[model samples]
Target: MAKAFASAGDMTEKTISFTEVGEGLYAFTAEGDPNSGVIIGDDSVMIVEAQATPRLANKVIDCVRSVTDKPISHVVLTHYHAVRVLGASAFGADQIIMSDKARSMVAERGQEDWDSEFDRFPRLFEGHESIPGLTWPTTTFSGRMSVFLGQRRVDLMQLGRAHTAGDIVIHVPDQNVMFTGDIVEYHSACYCGDGHFGDWGKTLDAIKAYDLDAIAPGRGDALIGREMVNAAIENTRDFVASTYAPAAKVAARGGTLKEAWDAVRAACDPKFADYAIYEHCLPFNVARAFDEAQGIDTPRIWTAERDKAMWAALQG
Candidate 1:
């Protein structure tokens, strides 16, 4: 039987878990769905990657309330994906931050992404009606910037592109904990529809250099040890490489997109078949890998129409 289009058929609710990975840092994870990080500063709080909707963001807020009474002062969107940013309004954060490239993406394809994602994943948009509009960052930075929540310092850096062009990682220097948004996933599929497959490994190396003690990854579990952290990083590296290699070979030989799809499935399914969103990300990952192999420097914008067309052509 043919698979459901994207994650449209994935409607089961995920169990939410709020884990303290550091002194006051928490990871709000829900099974294999998108995860968010909570950094508790001396005075206020900073949220990393808002959920897909206001109702979902409220869940994170509830978790925060259980731990501390501090006001949430900031919301950092690691990238411009609709699932991560559209929930920013619910945070009531005074500062909404993103990388410069991320801001541009919001202007360029934010609406298209919103439309596409909404149609593709209905469960994530549980409270879609509550979303005000497209989420725009109040502050934008280049390669790196630092935001201080009282004396505690939170460094946001664009450690090269991976998941998306504007991907950034949040580093709590004192705690030695990093919040890597979709850049490093544990037991979860990296959504590469708008990813940079070539630079993803190099970017992983940058994160590894830090040798972080704990990592609240974008999905799956909150990594809390050096061994677990390293394992997840390498696993993510392998997943990306495994997805791209076979597709690149197919593209190199002038194979059709469907051919590339089959080749990637043969290479990746054995290793990452059990991963969350594996099926949802497979087609897009194969397409991007094939495009990059053919010298497509930039990712093509994905619209709702484009999504259906690509799904039909490949999944049919």
Candidate 2:
């Protein structure tokens, strides 16, 4: 029998957890569902990643309300993924910030991504109608930008491209807390549909250079201690390398995409088989890795049509 398309069969709801990892830093995770980070500054709050839609985002807003009354003034898009940035309207943040490369990605394929992701994970888009169309960034920066909530300092830096062409990390220097949007996932499978495997490995190294006390990753539970944080980083690095190395080897031998995909699955399934979204992400991840190995640097836009075609060809 053919496998389910993307996460279409994943209909069960997950219990959400709001854990305070640091003094005012919180991670909103849902049993391996897409996670969001909250950084409470002295005078305002900054939301790291918006949920899928306004209705879903409201749940996050409620979580924020329970903790602090300070208004949310900033919403940062780690990259241009629909599941991450489409819910910006709910925050009422004055500044919707993103890396300049991310802004261009929104302009380039945001609509396609919205349609593609919605179909891929229908359960996650429970409030699809509530989305106010593509969420555009009101402000953008190139390398790094810093925002201060009174005396508290939060740094937003683009530390090379990994998950996407414009991935950025939110750093709280004083707290030693880093919100790595999908750049590093803990226990959860890394979705590499739009990933640059080569650059992604180097990006992980850049993140390790930080003196981190805690990390709220894009998915999975927050890492509280240095040991846990380092372990998560190493796990993510191994996942990326393990997946790409075999696929690259196949491509070097002039093998087909299906061959590369099969080889990668056989190698990775044993280790990451139990991880969340591992099966759902494998086909797309393999396709992107195969392309990169074949010398395709930039990722192709994945439209709803292309998503179906790819799934049918690979899983059918």
- Provide the TM-score for each candidate, comma-separated: 0.98, 0.98
Query: Which regions of candidate 2 fall more than 4 Å away from where they truly are?
Result: none
Global lDDT scores for all candidate models = 0.94, 0.92
Q: Give the local distance difference test score of model 1.
A: 0.94
Off by over 4 Å in 1: 1-3
Error of 1 at 298 (Å): 0.8
Expressed as tens digits, the lDDT of each residue in 71-160 for candidate 1 is: 999999999998998989999999999999999999999999999999989999987999999999999999999999999999999999
Error of 1 at 87 (Å): 0.7
Clashing pairs in 2: none
Deviation in Å, model 2, residue 156 alpha carbon: 0.3
TM-score of 2: 0.98
Query: What lDDT tens digits, residue by residue, belong to model 2 across residues 211-299?
Result: 68999999999899999999999999999988999999999999987888899998899999999999888889999999999999999
